[model samples]
Target: DPPLPRDVWLASTEVFLARGSAGSSDGLTLVAKGGHNGEHHNHNDVGSFLVAVDGVPVIVDAGRPTYTAATFGPDRYDIWTMQSAWHNVPVVRGRTQPAGRDATARGATAEIGDDASTFTADLAAAYPDAGLDHWRRRARLDRVAGRVEIDDAWRFADDAPTGDDTLLHLLVAGDVRLETGGARVIPEGGARPVRLRWPEDVAATAEVRHLDDPMLTEVWGGHLTRLALPLASRTQLQVTVELDTPIEDSP
Candidate 1:
């Protein structure tokens, strides 16, 4: 099939997608979303994103669990997949986004450039009680560089959390090996490992999540990896799909 668009900016929904030109095995597809917490089949993930390499989803959304009485109950937010902390979004002071239409992204904008596409939004509204004055997330897809960069600039109403309260999450449909500034995501089915990099100050942790839910396992195989990074304000994260250099399996 023909390659997807080089750049796509859905301004109304604040979602952006970018893919590399055809013919390069190392090309990447990036998807980013910024909206209210109360989306249709909401996930409380206002600034979540995903990355795919060679049609294999490396960074993923994990979708939803099987529907049940508890799925839509008043305590629906109790579900792990429904929380913002479980998605590829930032967690502030150990708090994720709250549910409700009132919890929305603000000052959202998109730009489709020749070489890169960018989507920026203020996610402070979606995460109330985090003492945030503003949480600005900017995701840029650079087709020329075959990478996606996400920059997060945040300001707190009071003193910023000096401890490990500020964190970042990335759910992956692959094996993750934690490294200095990031992790190498080894995709299932023999796809090459993609590199995810972050600032030096951020500490990375990998948790293996075995999918027991049939619905989740069907889409993501038997397991997934969650890369959690304890970070500070004004952090930048990057995902690079390399054309060369194979990553060796860890013993």
Candidate 2:
């Protein structure tokens, strides 16, 4: 099999897709987005991402539910799936990202290469009321290393809430099992399991949401799981994701 084309960066959309070559047993792909919160039919999910191993989405996006009368109303964000806390984003100071074009990403950059693909952006503007001076999120897919690393570093304003106030979330279409310093995501179907490792200081937890809505169930089957990591009382957090190598690639 030939190598896949290099990673893609959509500058206008502020979305990046990074992946290993097609022939690589480590068929890992990461899709990350950084755009304004006020997109049409949008979720308050700037700096959100998804992970797929061997073409199966493990860390995923819980797609929008069926449109209701209130779907486009002022209460649109009241829906859990429309909130940043439920998406693969950080909730800072207990505040989800605000919805508006004013709430946008800044200083976004991407570098596509054979060794690694990287996308980085400052997300502080996406949380207008979160009292953040800067929230820098870096998503890097290292083809040589066979892993994807998400690094988030932030600086809080003086008045921002103190004590473990930052929580990162990743929604998954899989079974999640907690381990020593991280968790393993075994995607339903026949996809290889993916490991999500975090810093020792971060506390990892999982939540399962059963999908009763037909719109959601049709795509995700019965349910989805959310892996939540509450950062230590600190300014930075890094989550590394690794996909198991195929048997043929083993020594």
Candidate 3:
């Protein structure tokens, strides 16, 4: 309440990433993820994310699919939901991600700060079986900009052929609409909608699928929705999911 300052604003640490949060009740929270594909219990998601708005999980993790005795067997990865294609990540060079320690997410780092925070991953090792030479993914939780930004850049091995299917995915319990350049998704609780966009220069198609899995059925009470992108690439690409309703902007 100083006269030198025309206005006074409060500051709070809203980012919860590598650094632990100093508990508060300001009602804003954002988390950045870091992990490799080969981690025994982490599953096949190498570059995925979990986002919440007003404490409501908007972009969710497609958690444990139904179980069978074979689910514990060597063939566990054969389960469709166990693959990377079903998570909030991308598929490289037409290959669904493999499950193994050798298939990994490398050099994962996260930086938390007052203005914004960032998390990055070197995904090259995660796609070795897909003929990849190098792959990197960067994600930013911009508290100032009120959106998360993602940039994925990759290259194929010298002898690798041109691609057929290169794409990304996001799993949700929300309703999704395919639009001109991206998609509009209403969060699971039917609160505000989130707009996920791809650049106009990049060619991408968005579609939602209804799944009738035995496990997803028992959990969510119905078929789940997955947003998929079949992409046309050029060694680099960017996709951004904008939270149309950022907490700071809401009443």
- Please provide, for model 3 over 31-63, each residue's C-alpha lDDT reduced to its tens digit, 9 standing for 90 to 100: 444455556555687767665544455566667
Candidate 3: stretches off by over 4 Å: 1-34, 159-162, 201-221, 245-251
- Summarize candidate 1's per-residue lDDT along 61-87 as a digit string, tens digits: 888999989888898899989988789
* 117-235: candidate 2 lDDT, tens digit per residue: 99999999998887888999999999888899999998888844445667888888877888878887777778898888887767788889988999999888999988888874777
Which candidate has the top score in TM-score? 2
Candidate 3 overall Cα lDDT vs. reference?
0.62
- Evaluation by lDDT, superior candidate among 2 and 3: 2
Every model's TM-score: 0.89, 0.91, 0.77
Clashing pairs in 1: none
**CA deviation > 4 Å runs, candidate 1:** 1-3, 22-26, 159-161, 232-244, 248-251
Worst 10 residues of 3 by lDDT: 6-15
Q: Relative to the true structure, how large is the alpha-carbon lDDT of every model? A: 0.78, 0.84, 0.62
Ranking by TM-score: 2, 1, 3
Rank candidates, lDDT, best first: 2, 1, 3
Those runs of model 2 whose alpha carbons end farther than 4 Å from true positions after fitting are 1-5, 22-26, 159-162, 245-251
* Number of backbone-clashing residue pairs for each candidate, in the order shown: 0, 0, 0
